[model samples]
Target: MGFSTTHLIIFLVIIIVIFGTKKLRNIGSDLGGAVKGFKDGMKDGTDRAADASAAPAQQVGTAGTAAKETIDVEAKTKV
Candidate 1:
């Protein structure tokens, strides 16, 4: 048979007993925070994507901070 409201309540009570209310509250807060952060990151990503599409592509010849981050190296073959 499918679970009734009473069965769900009993299950919740058991979980609360095992975990304790303080621990359950902390877990709930942490899970909520994680979900909030995930939502924020997704929104930021979409905003960045829209901005990128609206802006013109930068020229490769001129480098900004990206230039400073790169290192030029000559590859050598061992004899």
Candidate 2:
């Protein structure tokens, strides 16, 4: 035996009778929101990995403002 269009039509009718049209629409919208949230979470995870890989080159107290602070302190100690 083979499935045909009539079988699908009857199944659809049964679904509509059981759930009504409004409930089906709400279910579709909720499924769409869940898919969107999953995609956004995947993107955030990739961005965090990239930031972590590039973190070691930028030292906090090894140059620029920190170096000036060390020099100033040494000069003050001699006065």
Candidate 3:
């Protein structure tokens, strides 16, 4: 049969015994922080993408900095 509430409780107790509450708490906090950071980074990236797509003529963050100059050159074969 599938695991019941009692079985799940026992499994959790065993895990707690193997890794004490303090260690588990630290691990949980670290995981939470990593997830939060990842979400923030994704949001920032999405905002930048939206800005870029919204205006093809003006790049994002152009209000603060000068426009970048571009150059083109053909690649040559190495000797």
Tens-place lDDT per residue, model 1, 1-79, is 9999999999999999999999999999999999999999999999999989766556444457688877666554557
lDDT of 3 by residue, 15-48 (tens): 9999999999999999999999999999999999
Model 3 regions more than 4 Å off? 59-79
| TM-score, model 1 to reference | 0.67
Q: Each prediction's TM-score against the native? A: 0.67, 0.68, 0.66
Q: Score each candidate by Cα lDDT.
A: 0.88, 0.86, 0.86
Candidate 3 residue-wise lDDT at 49: 94
Q: How close is candidate 2 to the true structure, as a TM-score?
A: 0.68
- Candidate 2 residues 24-78, lDDT tens each? 9999999999999999999999998998877765665356777666655554764
lDDT: the better of candidates 1 and 3: 1
Model 1: pairs clashing at backbone N, Cα or C within 3 Å:
none
Span of ten consecutive residues with least summed lDDT in model 3: 67-76
Q: Sort all candidates by lDDT, best to worst.
A: 1, 2, 3
Ten-residue region with minimum lDDT total, candidate 2: 70-79
